[model samples]
Structure formats: C-alpha cells, structure tokens
Target: MTSAAAVASPATVRPSRGLAVFWIVAGLFGVATSFLLYLEYVGQLTGADPIVSCSFSPIVTCGPNLLSPGGNLLGFSNSIIGVVLFWGPVYAGVSSLAAPGGMRRWYWRVYSLFIAGAFLFVHFLAYRSVFEYGSLCPWCMTVWLATIPLFWFTVSWTLREGVWGTGAGTRRVGAAVYSWALLLTVLDYAVIAIAAQLRLDVIGSLF
Candidate 1:
C-alpha cells in the first residue's frame, strides 16, 4: 500500500488565459503586418507600380526601407522572416490552450529567447528608421507595436509562473515584473514616439 503523500505532483502548470489571449491577438497582428510588408516588397521587386497601402505620405512610407539593403539583411525581405517568426507565438497560444497540462518550462524559455531577440531587433529597426533611414514604415511600426507587448507579457508570465525558476526570490521578482508589464510596454511606446518626434518631428510631418 502507498501513502497518499507519496504520489508525485504534476510537472506542468496551466497557461494563463489572459497571456494566451494576448499571444493569439499579438501574433495574428504581427503576421498580418509582416505579410502586408512582404507583399509590398514582392511588388517592388517585380517592377509593378502597386500602390503601397502603408505609404501615407513622403515622411511615412515603406518604399525606402523596403528597398534599402537593411531590409534585405538576410538576402530577403525582413518581413518574410517576420511572417515566419510571428507564427510561433500563435502556435504556442493555440496548443497551450488546447492541451490539458499547458506548455512546459523549456518551451516558454525558448519562446522568450526568440521574443527577446525580436525586441532587440525591433529597437534596431526603430533606430534606423529614426536616424539612418529618416522615414517611418507604418507596417514596421505595427510589427513593433505587436512585438513590444508580446515580449513584455510573455516574459512577465514566464517569470510569474516559475518557468524561469521555482525559487521564492525568483517568484517575487516575476510577480513584481508581471504587475508592471503594461506600464513598461507603454513606456517603451513612449520612448519610440519621443524619438520619432525628436528626430523626424512626426507630428509636424503629419500636418
């Protein structure tokens, strides 16, 4: 006979509904924006005079960025990479929601690493848009918008759920970060907005 206390506990935790929903929405949004940009790039390459939907004005256009060597860093439109990468969060969200035990810790850690890379890459593109290229791509900004929150929330959730570790200090830090995730996301947006305003006078350019 085995004692009740001898049974092993389950290793997996249920995914947060809120975080899962965010992942779905943000991933879909990223995919849409990235696809749009990819289509525009394809049109450009094919020598078609397709009107770019995101090209609102001279200051706010995707033409230069799409045509620039920076956009083809990997010898293809960066948006093509975006189209592929954004699907990861969507799959994670869908599978985690459908699974009884949700996702494993290793899964989240790997996902977080990719998102961290995206966060860094997004900031680099923002820097180029502000200083190097001197034009704003609306679709690129949309991708940035989607990625920023996804990164913050995914990281916060991983921390709060013990994906990073199961220590008291780690949990405490994760909880603290989770509580401030939204405000931090807003602050990130503000940083980009302020930079654009300073370098490009985005508001003045609009008028």
Candidate 2:
C-alpha cells in the first residue's frame, strides 16, 4: 500500500456561535463608523457644518477633526476605503454562519489577513489623531476601539485553531507579542487622556 493512504486530512473546525455573533457585531460597528464618516464628508463638500446627533461633547464633533489634513491621510477621504473594506468581512462573517460546511480554512486565513490590515490602518490613523492632529473624531475613535477587540479576538481564535501556523511555540510567541502591543496602546491612550485633563484643569484654574 502507498504511504499516501496511511493518513487522513484533519477535520476542519467551525467557529462557535459566540464567535459568529462577535464577528457580526464587529462588522456592524465598522459599517456604522463608515457611515458616520461619509456623512461628515458630505457635510464638508456641501459647506454645511457637521451636526452632532449625539449629546453635545468635545469628543463628538466630526467636522473639525475630519477637515484636518491628517484626516485625509491619502489625499482623499478615508471613509471611502472604510466602506469598501468593512462590508467584505460583514458578508463573509454572515455567510460563514449560514453555510452548512462552515467557512473554509483558506477563507478564515484571508479574512484574518484583511482584518489585520484594517487594524493596522486604523492604528496608524489613531496615532496621527492623538499626536499630529491633536483632535478626536468620536465616530472614528469608536471604530478604532471596536477594531482593537475585533482583531484581537479574531487572531486569538484563528491561532487557537491552528489556522495561522503549525508550530505551537511560534503561535504562542506571536500571541504574546500581540497582547503586549495591545496593552501598551491602551496604556498610552490612558496616559494621554489623563495629561490632557490635567492640563485643561490647570489652565481653567489660572484663568
């Protein structure tokens, strides 16, 4: 007998119902954020001031932040790209849940890559917003926050299922690195927010 017949391919694993729901929620958030950005863009083009539908807060104004040079990083609106990329994962996630055979391994692999790319893109934008732009867009920040957990959960799930690599040690190291980076990013944001608050308080006291 040929050695080729000695072994069977491993069975494919499907994501749990919980994971399916997580993906759906993440996709929806991405869609909502993109829509808000589009609205801001329309307001800008029409020379109309962007209106905040939410409660009045410094963090809620999309206009001042969007019109800044850093917002249009690629010389055009980032929302256009966000709309296109956000829907792909949404469709794939919903289809994965409904399909009897579940999503193929390659499909998950591709989806992970796409989401990772998006996570990185958003990370860059957030960094620019904090350091260079010095202004925040509430919708964009919401999307950014949503993306952090979305990417982390997806990558963790994929890694656990052995979709990313065959070596367990390599996967562990990668996961550790990702976790540390996420923690550091969160801490950085916290520090920035605290410092900003302190500075504002001090200025108010002096006036």
Q: Identify the leading candidate in terms of lDDT.
A: 1
Judging by TM-score against the true structure, name the best candidate. 1
The whole-model lDDT of each prediction reads 0.81, 0.65
TM-score of each: 0.90, 0.74
Pull out the clashing pairs in model 1: none
**lDDT at position 66, candidate 2:** 78
As a whole number from 0 to 100, the lDDT of residue 111 in candidate 2 is 85
Off-target runs (Cα >4 Å) in candidate 1 are 1-10, 47-52
Count of backbone clashes for each model?
0, 0
- Cα lDDT tens digits, model 2, 1-207, are 001111113444466666666678778888888877878777877976665442134543466667777677788778777776777667766875677466556777888888888788877876666565555566787777767766766766666566666588766764564446457558655654565444433234324
Candidate 2's TM-score: 0.74
RMSD of 1: 5.7
Worst 10-residue lDDT window, candidate 2: 1-10
Write down the TM-score for model 1: 0.90
Distance (Å) between predicted and true CA of 32, model 2? 1.7
How well does model 2 score by local distance difference test? 0.65
